[model samples]
Target: MSSLPPASFQTPRQIFAAFDRGDLSRESFREAMNEHALQLIEEMEEVHQNPVAAWMEHLRSRRAAGKLGREYGEAMVRELLVALSEVPEFPLARWIWNADRPHLPLYCFLRPKAEPVFRIQKIVCAPFVVMVRVEYGSSEKSATVREKFTFTRDQVGRLRMSGRERVK
Candidate 1:
């Protein structure tokens, strides 16, 4: 008897053999993959719905904290939540080509015990228009730092396409 679940029914060998030496359409492959994922999620939800299984999960969590220490267990949960909550906001495919190129100035702050030098780079738009203030540091040697606010879309676009010259 096979211990493999129904979700593993479509093995990697089968899928690859099915597409042997042939070009597969992007839309068709995407649809098939999406359906497979949905089915797996449904099966997992079913497994987690049992009362005995739920109690086992609670016991496991308590045991983990006892073994690892309370701080370590709490840190693990916090990190997991942070990872789960993070969504890639940028469009990766479109931005990949320009990722290496410098667009905006990145901001940096150095402690007095360290180099005593500070830099503010790649400052861009803020979320709110009226309520928030945007500021950047000047030269590290300077006594007074200059603050800059307000940026235009044209400025950002120009930075994004910095290397190439415009054709007349």
Candidate 2:
């Protein structure tokens, strides 16, 4: 009954535009972003090249060409830069950026109208444990978040997070 387009056929930019125009519900947009992020993670895992760096450069070019708004473009660039630096851990980093962050996918929701910037302060990857320290927020307010995750392989041999906790 809804008028929303199929998320599988739309790019993240298209989904964002649809949400901005009131054509897509908030929850739908979130799901679409999740799907897109997952697909990107899978693709990044398969590539041997530095796709993350290429992606960041592409974003910069898009911003330079005025395809994306200034604030939104800058914010995305910052987020992608962090992901690029994270390399083999880029999948988890990208997931955290897109899925773990509550206020993402809707940049206009920030109270003070400042674009958020994301930075990964530390990442320690052990045998079955991952600890990441990240700082993200707008100029007005920011948060340093640390998360620990224990991972294990599933029956199908796909790596999965067995447990996760926000470290205080």
lDDT of each: 0.29, 0.44
Residue pairs that clash (backbone atoms under 3 angstroms), model 2: none
Put down candidate 2 lDDT per residue, 33-137, tens digits, no spaces.
898778667545644365665456445444432432343344443343333333333223432334224355322211121123433445444544444454434
Question: For candidate 1, lDDT tens digit of each residue in 12-117?
Answer: 2234444564544656555655655675476457547765754554454445434433433333322222221121221111112222223411111111111211
Clashes of each: 6, 0
Number of the predicted model whose lDDT against the real structure is largest: 2
- Which portions of model 1 show Cα errors greater than 4 Å? 1-9, 51-168
RMSD of each: 20.4, 15.6
Give the local distance difference test score of model 2: 0.44
